[model samples]
Target: MLKSWTAMFAAGSVISLLVVVSSTSALRGQPQPGLAVASAGSIHLALGNPSGATEDPANKDNFLVSKPQYALSYNDANGIANWVSWRLNKNDLGIQGRCKDSRGRDFFAADDSLPTGFKQIKPDEYDFPVNGFDRGHMAPSADRTANRPDNCATFLMTNMVPQRPNLNRQVWESLESDSRQLVTRNGRELYIIAGPGTKRGTIADNRVMVPASTWKVVVVLDAPELGLAGVNRNTRVIAVNMPNTKTISGNWRSYLVNVDQIEALTGLDLL
Candidate 1:
């Protein structure tokens, strides 16, 4: 139905299809075609795709939500000021997971994750008691609590990459705070898509990195009240890729713009 409608109706609808569903790692010199710059978080970008023709990584259809909350980080240099541990779920799953099957490797396998999202897998058959890479998290513990594992399951080793201690302990913690704040503010459930980094092809030398280098994390916030529309109407989306810079430095697409400029850019009544 959706495919036929776009084929029959809008011409622009075509490009919108693939871009809506894909989340690429940081690109070299291009901002994602349809995203806008967001002001909040270490990185921010978002867009509206009412069609639902494309599948989102964080889309609820592909995943389920569990206890996602923030818990305080014991390693916070700032002490009690650092209250984190938002989403808490184990990555390694038992047998019978949707993506797991005894015949194949586990999607959340620590040292032995099979090719996930491509096929079905079982738990016992997974590369368990594995080693090498950390059980990384797409949705860090800084964002969830003791809840359902499906949503938390999405944050498993498959979506994890070995992050640096400083990045996780301090920097990413900040990003976590912002993520929780938004979900709290929305009052409506938000969908989050996250996955682990792979070390197979071009990144042959790279392990599932624990510390985020270049810090190209991205955040997308929607809902009229956020004032996102005021920025760049063409891209009511925020885009910023990890810069590959040594110190993990970057800013939001909205960092340079003010609320007024955003209002002008989007022509929305953001003020």
Candidate 2:
């Protein structure tokens, strides 16, 4: 049977100030290596030029270049590989690091939120509410236990937000499932990084190259043989966002956002 692939995850990112959202990078971490990592700031979270992020071509939209961040073992519960101190770099953050086992099973605890070196951010202090925000994922659920509990720390209130239930469960989730399956089925692996982006100006749902809350799940497949497209030796990018379910109607349609032709608008040399 020519089976199809599937990937699943919610669409949204919200939580308290103490939260550690994983909406930007791939799911590659080294918490087992005992390295201290912290949540990204607004500039760090910017997708276009704020943070100077790269891109992923496999998934729906070209997103970012996520990387693995690790640390030595911390506590015995996390079963960390080491506890020695280390440092995580830029390649270790944002929509480039949202993949499966290719990354670590656990995410980092806050530098201030009680020594998060391979330490799981237990939800004891913070409450994870269903109506509050979307279950912002760190290490991709596929990388953890089926229920995303192997590294329960990654599922903290700091890494979540309010997301649309339908889109989260429908198109977006399908993308996640398909990505992971592409790895197992093809004997390869896929890396992904997802999250939110805000445009420079605000106009009440102003449309930009990247939309807010679109739950931009930037996926990066390692092997080129997974029948993948939208990428190249350098980088191919996709920038899809969550649908505005609040106003989405069947009678709606989207087309090119310009009056001039492609050459006129971009002013590029096509001839």
Candidate 3:
């Protein structure tokens, strides 16, 4: 049988959908005989879909886009992702490096997969030095280096947000590196969700909204093969909420927060 739960935000507004599958067939990567898998073969959301996003064009703000590399809820009005979730394991790591364009510059391209009428953010829209924001990635490039195409998928503009230099390069990057350490060194599998919070303002001719803060939830598991069944009360969940400003701590641990706090802030039931 299939069961589900809902989490309401502190504001008494937003609600999060949590789907739980009980069948052994579902755990084995197959849908139960009568049910259909939403995004077949995509293990990125093995844990859950935080916001209940769908591919329905009418739900522009919470539109779901699933890919082999990762899955994200694209917000059309904000021109950013509501959240991006992916599963990380040692097998996903490799010697492959970041992708580049013909000129050998870092390739940040528009996601042609977005439905028509959705603005496809351009790489140059970030306006780097002038804007003082890095084209921050929700799914860090290093986390998807298993192959060329996988790594390149991370460069899609839809997976990016405007982030301050200090937070992006220092604390955020450090946390990303540590997440990989859990996989490469400690032999752990992780299901991570990350996104912007509380839009502070807009950029690129008011095309993309800048968030006041950024947050992430990392659920560490003992093994990738075990998947969601491995998670329990003892699971190690690392959630962090960091301010997006010029001044911030270099250590990611300094911004640690509880998953409930993140849910209150982002209104997503991250598991």
Question: Could you report the Cα RMSD, in angstroms, for every candidate shown?
Answer: 16.0, 16.4, 5.7
Tens digits of per-residue lDDT for model 1, 158-227? 3344443444444444554554555555432222322222212112122222222222222233442433
Q: After superposition, how far is residue 52 of candidate 3 from its true place, in Å?
A: 0.9
The whole-model lDDT of each prediction reads 0.28, 0.28, 0.81
Superposed on all Cα atoms, model 1 deviates from the true structure by an RMSD in Å of 16.0
Off by over 4 Å in 2: 1-133, 136-139, 146-150, 199-212, 217-219, 222-239, 244-271
The candidate that wins on lDDT is: 3
Best by TM-score: 3
lDDT of 3 by residue, 91-187 (tens): 8999889998999998999999999999999999999878989999999999988899999999999999899989999999999999999999999
Model 1 local distance difference test score: 0.28
Worst 10-residue lDDT window, candidate 3:
6-15
What TM-score does prediction 1 earn?
0.34
Candidate 1 clashes: the total is 52
The estimated TM-scores of all candidates read 0.34, 0.37, 0.87
